[model samples]
Target: MKVTLPDGTELQLEEGATGGDAALAIGEGLARAALAVSVNGELRDLARPLPDGAQLSIITGKSPEALELIRHDTAHVLAAAVMELWPGVKISIGPAIENGFYYDFDFPEDAEVSDADFERIETKMREHVKAKESFTRQDISVQEAIEKFKTENQDYKVELIEDLITNEGAETVSLYTNGPFTDLCRGPHATDTGKIKAFKLTSIAGAYWRGDAKRQMLTRIYGTAFLSKEDLAEHLHMIEEAKKRDHRRLGKQLDLFHFSEISPGSPFWHPNGMKIWNSLHELWTEQNARRGYNRVKTPILLDVDLWKISGHWDKYRDNMYFTDIEDRPMGIKPMNCPAHIQIYKSERRSYRDLPIRYSEDGLVHRHEPSGTLHGLMRVRHITQDDAHIFCTEEQIQDEVIQCLRFGFYIYEIFGFEPKLELSTRPEQRVGDDATWDRAEAALENALQAEGLEYELNPGDGAFYGPKIDLHMKDSLGRSWQLGTVQLDFSMPERFELAYTGDDNDEHRPVMIHRALFGSFERFIGILIEHYGGEFPLWLAPVQAKIIPVSDLFNDYADQVAQTLVDAGLRPDVDARTESVGKKIREAELSKAPVMLVVGAEERDAGTVSVRRRHNAGDDDAKLTIGELVDVLSAEVAERRRPDAG
Candidate 1:
């Protein structure tokens, strides 16, 4: 039999030769370094044999695939350690994630793992790694696997295997063995335990099986692995940076917002926080107005009948928040498309009025699971910067392109280079084959016309449509999905939305649902983290702080602050009886973009000592009050985002 290498070279090998044998045939060095093989693009263990003539790419320790193998192996090691110490714990599933891996286990009644057990587990894992135990893969029949796990009293493993066999009709299952530990898993693990050069168990949390809250909760241990110690240290440093910029902590310190148990996924915006919200809304309103979008407001609660007509009640009832109005079922709007359709249906339209764009900062309520809720990132009540465009089928591409351009403008203001993604039909989608194909093609052409590269995320689109998702990178190099443009053929049909065509016949108008910033709450959270709470001059709640050098200068400070406020800046006067240095320190800590020092001399000269946030100079430059306002206004008008570069 012949095996093909990545470079397209073919080697004649013995029939049923494993990947390791092929590697050894190539060279001794290659065989020693080979960790796994990508058999025709599918990763497999070194022990897996090539079937007939096949293309294979050997993975080494330096490859990303090899790193994933190491992390997966580390998870098995950690699970083995846990079972060794506890003796009766049942292992469920362990899988490698983006930064690391996690293993879930069902513990004994009296034995619960905690932070204190992490040290012992880590020690045991290291011992296993040092022992260099080879991972052996074994295949067993479904019945045999079930019997084995049932005999060992591993109910979770047995249940998992049974479900797989029942649902997927899996005839045989694979198990990996290392030392005294064995786990049910698929192939593509490291060649041996010695490949796990560096690893650390980060933390443990309670997770329900398959994330269903009603199911029995299991202990999930999270850990990370790297090829070298230095890489591990760098990853740890990046984690520290993320921790330092955690928006929840910054939100509290800045008096921005808070969450309460009564409203698990809702936020209460404080005065300072509301300022930020208002600023963003004002910008949104002004931009949409310029873009030919008519600002509109709709009812927050609508009759369930409207939702039924719009297909929301049937499709998204699980996430919709329902209320009772005089015994009639009413739902808090979870999206703005239904209401926008109502507006479009309110009037008879002709071909001349074909593209009707309606924009609104719509407040939506969704009943997110309590466990999935985060600070402000994931919330129940949110105000979406949403719009819907009613256009003819011919206008789809142009409308989509315009929406993409608008999204780019918004992201560019925040110094973000947007990443685009084209999401196709989901499993539970509503459109017919031809309509879906046309809609997907329209989105693809729009992206191509704009000359933008995008990833195709299969089966992640809205139920009603395919969508283009826009993501932006932040200062910490983390990406956030902010904008989306969805092409909806189902909603208009469901709502019976129609317009008179040029042929004088009524035709269905295609609806394009878009949101530049998915939700104000989540976007604000991302902005907080992106800027590390040091918002740009335009977005800062308080752009400037006026500090009085002494009690004698309090009046001057107040006057300066009032002048700045009248000039369209959010300024605050610090009249507290603190030292000038303390006041300056407070302003710096608050991340105010500019600080104005008012003293007897400056008050008499009608000038102020201006200290810029990004400046490192020790000297404070003196500028006239009018000149200062001009400088500050220019900075704000420029709409410079935080230094993402």
Candidate 2:
């Protein structure tokens, strides 16, 4: 049989030939470098038999999919090492994740494992790699696979095979073996353990099996792999930088917020954190007004019937919080769109009011899993900078362009350049194919009209519509999805929303759901890390720290703080009766954007010496009270970053 290569060249091979055989047919060098083969765009193990007349592309170290395969192969090496080090350890599933891979294991009660064992595990992994153990794949009957694991006391593998057969109606399962370790996996791994050139076991944590809270907790080991040691070193350096800039640590150091057992995923915002929230809130309000949006608020809880009509009951009910109110089921709103739709339907609107824009800084609650919650990044309680636009189909392009520009404008203020992604309709959605096609086309046209380049993210849209998602990388080079503009034709139809057209007939108004800042909680977390707790003047909780040289100048510092307050600047007087030098050190540690040092000389001169944190060029410029306030207010008004210059 003959198979087509990526370059459209055909290669003849034996009937039982595998991807390995095809690569060797192409060239010896390619066969040696081949990690796997992409059979008809799907990755297949090199040892797997190649299909006749299939298009095959060699997956080498340079391929985008290489890292995932490397990490996954490394995970097998890790499991093999751990089981060797500690006998009787039961292994669960292991898969490659973003940035790395992790394997969950049910450690024996007598065994204690931690990151301290990483060195030994890595040593054993290297030995396996040095052995050049080729990954051998075998297909076995489901019952035989179950029996194999059951006899080995690997209950997890037994359970998995049973699920595949009972739930998925599977009759066969695949297993991969390297050296003496075997795992039940549907895999497309590297040819051998030797392919994992550089790897490190990064961390260890506890995770409930399959993310179910009721299940037994398993020990999870995370590690990353790269083709070269240089790439691994760079990634390790970034990981170290990320640790120093972790928002949770900064939040505590800066007195921003804290999580409590009383409310698992809810944040108890400190006064300092509230300052950041208010700053973003103020901007959200001002921008909405400039864009002709009417700000509104809605109830947090609504009847589940509303969700059923919105199709979220069927699609998103698993992630929602539900309660009983007056014997009727109520769902805490996970999103504001359904509630906003009700407001749109309340009044009879006209084509003149077609582009009715409603903006809400609304609080929403979701039933997030306990393990998935991160300090502020992932929370059960959230405040969304959400807005919905009701407009005619003809107005879609302009309205969408406005939204795109609005998102860019907001992100640019924080020194972020967001990349756009056009996400199309999902398989499980509420609308007809024709409506979804129109919605997707409208979004794509808007993006083209704006002259913006975007990546096509297929089947990742909301259940109601297709959307344009904005993802931005932060200072640490980590990308995050923050803004979205979704176009929906289904919601209006489902809710029976209408506006009278010029023809004196009612027509369904298209709904455009948009948000520049996805959620206050998550955005603040990103900002905390982005700025490294050294916020700009406008967002800084304590914009200026007023330090008096001694108790003699305390009164002057108080007066200065008051003047700053009257000028709409946040200032705090550091009057601890400490030395001026000590006070300055503490102020710097606090990350105050500006420090106003008041001494006898400045007091006599009726001015304050200005000291900018993190700025080495310090002449300690003296300015009068009036001059100081003007400069600070100007910077705050402009929302200038300390490093913008």
Candidate 3:
């Protein structure tokens, strides 16, 4: 049989030879480093036989696919160790997640396991890695596989097999065995346990089986693995830094916002939080206005029939909050696009108004499971910086480019470098293939026209359209999806949105859904962590704090505060009658960007001593009140970052 390598080189091998054989045929070193193989773009186990003329790429530790495989193999080792330590532990499923892996297990009632048990489990995992247990795969009839697990009291495995047979029409199931433990899986794991070099069990939590709240609760153990010790150490350090910069903790310490039992996943924004929100809103408004976007407001609750017309009733009802209002079924909107469509259709439009942009800081609601909700990142109530552009088909590419540019501009102001991704249609979308092809092509062409590089995210688009998604990397090197521009043909067709053509004939319009800051709540959460709560002057709730050296200087502090307030900046007078040292310490702790100390000398000089939080610079630099206001105002006007001079 012949196989093609990634570099277009052809390799000849005997029939029925496996990927491991091909790797050895290429070189001895490759075979030793090979973890798996990608055959014709599909990942396969090294022991799996290669087909004739298949394109094969050997995966080594340096390959991007290696971490997932290593993490998955580490999970298998974890399950093996758990089963050995606690006999008769029923394992449900284990898979690699972002940066790590987790396995769900139904432990016996007599067993007591927690994070405290992580050390012993990790010790056993090290033993497995040291033993160099080879991962062996076997395919068996569904009945035989079920019987094998049933005899071991693995009911979860039996249920999984039954579902696969019923839903996917499977005739056989694959099983992988490493040393004393075997699991039902379709795997492309590392060649052996020894390939897992550096790993650590992170934590444990209770999770519902299959994420169904009604199903049996299982104990889930999370762990991360890396191919080298240095990588693992770097990742562990990032984890510690992430904990210190957690948005939830910062939110409380900064008195930004808080979640309460009165409103489960909704935030009660404090004054400080509102200040940040208003600053963002001002930016959002100014950008939209400059781009010719018409701001509009939409109702939160609308009749269910409206949703049915938009296909949200069929496609997104599960995630929506619905109510019976006046005996009419109503849905609390999970999105603003549908309502924007109605506004476009409210009156007749012409080709002259081909691109009618409607922007909204729309409040929306969605049904989120209590367990899945995080501080502000994942919430039931949301405030979307949403917009819809109703444009002619001929205008799609340019409008999409404009949206891309708009998103890039907003992210730049926050010091984020965004990466672009073109997401294609999903399997369960509403649009036809031809329409989908056009939408996807338009987006790709726009990116190409702008000379912007993007990744292909397959089958992850919105239900109505293909989209260009912008994922920004924060200061901590963590990526977050912050913006999206979706090109939709289905919704306009569904709503029968039309405009008069130049020839006076009616023509269908294309709908582009865009949001730069995906949601105010989530964006703020990211900002909190991105800046480590030391916000820039423009976005900081308290731009400057005025501290008096003594009670005699309190009057000067209040006068300086009034001057700052008149200059359109948020300033607070620290007249608590405390010592100057304590006031300075408290101001720094509050993450105030600037501190102004007014003493008798400064009062007579008509100047204030300035201190910067984190001492970025300018400690004890005295400036007159006018000079101080001018500098602070310029920083706020330019939206300068705290770290930037």
Q: Which candidate leads the pack in TM-score?
A: 1
Clashes of each: 0, 0, 0
Tell me the tens digit of each residue's lDDT in model 1 across 1-645. 998988989989999899999999999999989889888889998998888788988899877687778889999999989989998898999998889999999999999679888999999999999999999999999899899999999998888898898899999999999999988898668789998889998889999998899999999999999888998988888888889889999999999999998778899999989988888888898899999899999999999999988778877899998889899999999998888888887889998997999999999999899979999999999999999999998899999999999998888888776888999999988878898898899999999999999999999998888999898888777888889898888888888888988899999999998998899999999888888888988889989899988999998888888888899999998899999989888899999888999988898999999997867567899999999999889877777654632
TM-score of 2: 0.89
Pitting candidate 1 against candidate 2, the one with the higher lDDT is 2
For model 3, residues 17-77, the per-residue Cα lDDT tens digits are 9999999999999999999999999999999999999999999999999999999999999
Greater-TM-score candidate between 2 and 3: 3
User: Which parts of model 3 are misplaced by more than 4 Å?
Assistant: 14-16, 48-52, 87-90, 138-175, 182-185, 208-216, 301-305, 313-331, 424-441, 457-463, 616-619
Report the C-alpha displacement of residue 312, candidate 1, in angstroms: 1.3
TM-score of each: 0.92, 0.89, 0.90
Clashing pairs in 1: none
Would you give me the overall lDDT of model 1?
0.89
